[model samples]
Target: MNTLNSNPVHGATRLNDWGLIRASGEDAAKFLNSQLTQDFALLGLNEARLAGFCSAKGRLQATMIGWKASEQEILLALPAEVLPGLLKRLTMFVLRAKCKLSDASGEWQLWGLTGTDAEQWLGDAAPQTRWSLGQKGEATVIRLPESGAQARFLMVQAKEAADPALNPLSPSDWQWLALQSGLAWVRAATHEQFVPQMLNLELLGGVSFKKGCYPGQEVVARSQYRGTLKRRTFLYELEGQALPGQEIFHSEDPGQPAGLVADVASKDGRSLILAETKIAALASGSLHLGSIEGPLLQPRPLPYALTEPE
Candidate 1:
């Protein structure tokens, strides 16, 4: 298996290394369950989940990859750059909660596996934390049920035993999977610019409609139930750093910005970008960037349908 390594936790696909926050205390699950879009309290022992922390007005503030280490504790994996703001925001609501949140990325290692089968991954005898993959696999493979998408992203504590023989994926492999799947991850440029649904979070299980109140719940619910959303994320190919949130325009409407690049990456000589755009702009193949007037923003298939009009 192709691989890349990080000194903090050597010899594995240190895929997208990010900051980890360990939330602990009697009210940990309860507090987070009420805050994030996912029901963290019901998270299985060997499972990791994607959740969003949004503003009270139903705008996304942060996106998280979390796993419950115990009934009273959960490890929240989020971008290091986005951590400080998240902690401060979370602490603001700590008026009467029984939870303590701390930066914990230093003590753990995360990995991703690809170009190999799940059976082979299970055979590698590493006393690793078996994360749930849901309907995507053995609750270990990250899979999208409605979309039938399957992939594996795993984590290991730095102190734990990790064997290189497991044949993990290279960082690029993890990236390619995301690009191919047509998923757009928020980056520094696109930070705090989108609500969860704008990036198709509900389709990816990153948003929970049935969950109790949390930041941005009202707007998220409204967008889903009433289909009042004005924009949505899309996949497009270009060249160069796909500057997250960069504008995509068309020659016909050069005066007005058409779309924004949500994520960008260097693939071969071309760049693949996830852009959020209006349905009207995308219907026509007139999207352009720079002087390339006719460079069409070809729409790629997403894993799930956008929640539609009521």
Candidate 2:
């Protein structure tokens, strides 16, 4: 981890790593609702959803923030590396649905705002509530839940428009804040590595248990009801860099990995990681980064409580 300077610019920045996917036509909402874990069919114009696109085996391919742009159009924000392939795959499934999926990355400029004045900077465009939407001029603003040491919000505007006046933050700095928030964003390195529950997606209101079937709906439901899931995501801090998909080792079982890194960011010479690990290992053994001889990890409390099976 690198020690960050006291400069205020670290608080906010333009987000270039994220891209957009646009779904258009009459069946946009219905198609997305069937494919993702969120209940998009009922999503109002003023609301947004955190959703996951999974594989048939229940592994997550992408985690996205989705919102309705109009009655016939929906926009999804996700990592750019996974967007192209995901859009292609989703297009293959629109056999009869009146929907079209396209990569609309070039159509929008995404910005991440954090710090005490994050809301005031957006003025009327700042969403008044979490998971809600607001409009300012041509920009669409969504207030992300309080993450890290400050408030955070995501602003999306047309590419042809002028950039907002907020101080620019480095992509790395933004990532650090996001990791500290305890919300995991799936990237290419860890694609299809874990199911929604392993990342605590359900606790974040990303999963809808009463919705109809999607790709991995059966496996997700089974894990929720049968008490069959033994692994879950947790926040940890260590003194070295921890990359996504890196193996986590336990001293008691050095021959095999105990878990994998889901998301990581460095700050003030320390690394923060969101890891999916076996619950038993968390209780009985000491966990290390990378390998058995790697740096030790200290557990940290998550921002939200985990939902236990009923």
Candidate 3:
């Protein structure tokens, strides 16, 4: 394993926790369109989309950042731990669709770029908007929502391609920056636990209410228009360690779980956690990491607004 360590303000780090999936064939785009929350059929060459792969009950099985490499090929970036199982599950659905799904993690490299290093790597070709795509030689870069004022980016290139030479960044800082952006990729521990809305995925452009039928389109759509949603994901600062899939508890209702930890990144003694909980729980009582006596969770503002689109 290649570990890069350097200043947190500006550097590039190998994202070992992420995996790549490639979908190819004449029906690649169309087949993905029918299974994911994003409108893959209309995906553009210059844009990437945040999407959710859900179960029939509308729980997210996996979440991904995907883009079109070509009309016949689409690339998806997701948690490596969940890749094999997801790949197997998706392959089972491609019976006669003319699409081939395979694990591409070993054939490609993924990197996380932060601050000036991100800007320097792409220079004039850097993508400005979130989820936008840019190209610099053989590397494909996707702009991500900023963590505070520091810009963030994801770069993908062939496994044999030369690595970008810049300062090295520790994995912890890279993960912290990603968590600060309030975006969480579904991991194996979190599989089939949350609906898109519960993670505020729709708020982050991860769900398409207007798209055609998908695995759980009706459930997702109903959650959107049926009534006011009572649960949502929020950013929080915890003084103690926390991990994804851990149960969160409320002070008022200590016997039962108030929510689930969607993602967590710890550095030093503090941690940044993206947890989904009851919206009402935020309004009154306190939240804890495991039990009512577990680490206290302090609410933090999200980088993006949570208002539902009109």
In candidate 1, what are the lDDT values of residues 1-310, reduced to their tens digit? 1111211211236644567788999888888888889988777765677888887777667787787767788888776767888888888887789999888877766555443354344454222332354322222233222211443445444635454355555665456455655556666667677877778877766876777888778878887887467788876665445556678886567878876787665545556667887767766557776434635555555655676545
lDDT top scorer: 3
lDDT of 2 by residue, 179-291 (tens): 76778989788999999999998888889999999999999998899966788999888996888999999999999999999998886577889999988897777999989
Model 3 per-residue lDDT tens digits across residues 144-197: 888877899999999999877768888988888888788888888899999999
Instruction: Report the lDDT of model 1 for residue 112.
Output: 53
Candidate achieving the largest TM-score: 3
User: For every model shown, what is its TM-score relative to the native structure?
Assistant: 0.82, 0.94, 0.95
Clashes of 1: 11
Ranking by TM-score: 3, 2, 1
Poorest lDDT segment (10 consecutive residues) of candidate 3: 1-10
Q: In candidate 1, residue 96 scores what lDDT?
A: 86
Evaluated at residue 224, the lDDT of candidate 3 is 88
Worst 10 residues of 2 by lDDT: 1-10
Candidate 3 is scored at a TM of 0.95
Candidate 1 vs candidate 2: the TM-score winner is: 2
Each prediction's whole-model lDDT (CA) = 0.64, 0.85, 0.88
